[model samples]
Target: MPPQLVLASGGGWGAAPKMENGQPVPGEFVVPNGVPVGSVAYFQVGNPNPSYVITTVTWDGGTDIKGYMSGTPTSAPAKKQEVLTGVAKNQTSYTFVVKAEAKNYTVRADVQYANGAKGWVTVEFASVRPTTTLAVPEDKVGFQATGDTNTHNVAGLVQAIFFQATATTHQHGGSFIFMQLVKSARVESAYFENNKLVKEYIENDRSIPNGEDFDGKLHDDFLNRLAYLHIYDGNIMYGWHLMPGRSMPVPAAPPGGTPDPPMMFDDPKSQVPLDWIGNAFTSSFSTYLMYKPQSGVWVALNQIDWSVSQAATRTGPGGTWEALTLPAPTQVSQPSTPNGMAAFPTWVNFTSNFINDQLNPWRPLD
Candidate 1:
């Protein structure tokens, strides 16, 4: 007699049955249709007839199986036989596809059964996202020159005292003011001729041919005008002498050593008379003034009055040692000279002309 075929629930094939006449009966076998990446599947089959003893069960394709059973069919519902169990390979969602050809697979119960039955399984896959970050650079600081108090003397001259600046940190733009004290002298009195005889002697002397010898008030007015104009600018200050070469440890004379005073020339033949002259006396002092538009504040940095002398001089009355207070910015337009000399401001023309010619070439260093 021919053996009967049985089928399993999961995925498995039953034993091959004998041929009744010329055709062999079909048996149960389970196969996988499709499967997703990173997953497993199983199949099984069972036998019903008790007369037949299953010897072997095989699948068409070489698929991996977990477990199997082979024995004579004693029970009505005999244990199911497993054909194959397979595990799908790892792949991305876009790479996974369904095809007719048998690829990777898995099975659970492996055995031959008396009854014909079959089954299959499938799975799916997905894709992942990527990771990332960002970075930036740092910022820098800046600096510039603003003002000084000693450039008036160099007015109209080719090389004169100038306001110099350097960029210590960054780049910027603005203007600076340089101030100075220029000392000029005139004949005050050659010989004290107040009496009749003295006046007659002075009149007879051709060298003393002058009207109003020299007035102390005139000299006072000249110095006072210079001082007042500087103070009014708010960008300048008073200094006794010009600082030469911007030199360090400025030369000084010994105490009370009869330091050489500035020379005075009184040649009657010369067109310009009463020249107060001396290279040692020619010097400039410097102080810095800065205006910050953002903060609206005018800052005064280091202020130094450079002078050259054998020794420090005393602050005597009616001397250049006197300090003058600066006028308010509002009062700068029209300034009044304390001592009476020329009613007009002389230093203004001096500074304006100097800036136009000599100091125009002055630029900040890198």
Candidate 2:
């Protein structure tokens, strides 16, 4: 009888063996008539006759399969056959083609079967890209100093006077003038005269003699004088002088002696020659006399503190001194005063030693 083949319990079929003398036969078996890409295939072999030796069951082109099976069945034509399992090596040679869109990729897998059959399948995956963002620019702010306006060309002189005043008795108090220069604005120059804004005149003529009096002239000329002197002159000085009433007595004759013969006021010979004598009186007195003389003899006096000159020294019981004490109310207090009213007291306060310390060389009495 020919060897009978039967379907296996494991969803596979077994091949009929060639038989002789009613004995079992052996043959090779192949599995998976067709293998899909990414799919696994399995198979089994059986030997019944003890003398029927089982040889190798080889698989061809099973490289793409993911798993394997092998076993020798104990009973011939049994209902169930046990399969020995093995792993299929990954098929590196199998090519998987992929198509990509903006955010995803599609992969098609083609598989070659052991029996020269091939299969294909497709799968999808995701893709991504990178991203970024940035920022903007901004503006700036600040200030600048512009000096006096009255004297358009004497900023340096103004500064010098300011420093001098500050160094002396002028308190650290005064107004400041300034302006803002916007982006890229150039500063041509700045003139500072008593906190007034003047045209910038950095390089023009800047000479200002100490006592070169200014008459009622051009406003610019008056301002130039003020700038050079750092002291208000002209009408400003007039008001300033009047503010402090005269304190010194007119020069007189010696006790019970005759007064010096009056010289014609207009006579150059009769008029007392003006001089820059030093230490003639107390600073206040000298200052008043220096600018507002009463007679040939210098006398102590006062003013509204616009500016004044005075004796180089005043004698005290201790010794001859060389400093001047500025009066209080250093600045002008009001715009007007009663007619004939003195800004300060009328009586002059001279110590007993005042007469002996006179530094003037040509005192009328002397």
Highest-scoring model, TM-score: 1
Show where candidate 2 strays beyond 4 Å: 1-320, 324-331, 335-366
lDDT tens digits, residue span 121-224, model 1: 22211110001000010110111112333222211111211222211111111111222322222111111224311111001111112332211111112222
Provide the lowest-lDDT 10-residue window in model 1.
Answer: 128-137
Across 1-366, the per-residue lDDT of candidate 2 in tens digits comes to 111122211112122333457663333222212111111223322233334333322223222212211111111111111212233323322222111111332323343444444433322323211110000001101011223232211111111101111001011111111000001101122223465433221111111233221111111111212111122211112111111221111134567442221110000000011221112211111011111111111111221122222222223222333334211112221112111112111221111111112311121211
Residue 314 in candidate 2, Cα distance off native in Å = 7.2
What lDDT score is found at residue 337 in candidate 2?
17
